[model samples]
Target: MPSSDDEATADSQHSTPPKKKRKVEDPKDFPSELLSFLSHAVFSNRTLACFAIYTTKEKAALLYKKIMEKYSVTFISRHNSYNHN
Candidate 1:
């Protein structure tokens, strides 16, 4: 014969635990397959780099250059013009 307050407390204690939030990794930060997937996105460097407040223009320029180089490599691979002598 438990009191109503005791029953309520027991019910609250038995409630399900909070669901664990899924951890999504940042694509640009990973340098994984996402790099290729997002290669063609317009203004992608500016957009993605916006995630961090302190990302400097120099750093953005370097990242954009690297991404462009990767795109050029992929292009040359397809066209066989890697060395246009």
Candidate 2:
């Protein structure tokens, strides 16, 4: 009779191999006008996680409006109020 350790090894050898993760493809045709508004951007894989824009308050508001109209997004802002000075 096989020992418990031997049986465990046999079971592991018979188990199916792990599946490979599929690569996420970035968008092929992004809007040019929106691209002009961004000063900096960061993407993780195919997802845009952060971006920045330098412009007048009015222009910033307009950009925000345009983005809201074009995409479904949940905006998150972070602030650190503690000063270490």
Q: lDDT winner among the candidates?
A: 2
Which residues of candidate 1, in runs, are more than 4 Å off?
Answer: 28-85
- What is the per-residue lDDT of model 2 for residues 1-85, given as tens digits with 9 covering 90 to 100? 8999999999999999999999966444444555676645454567665564434445667777787788677883322223332
**lDDT values of the candidates?**
0.49, 0.61
What's the true lDDT of residue 5 in model 1? 100
Could you give candidate 1's per-residue lDDT for residues 1-85 as a string of tens digits? 9999999999999999999999954434343432455444455335342222224445766665666675443331111112322
TM-score of each: 0.28, 0.38
The lowest-lDDT stretch of 10 consecutive residues in candidate 2 is 76-85
Clashes of 2: 0
Question: Model 2, which residues run further than 4 Å from truth?
Answer: 36-85
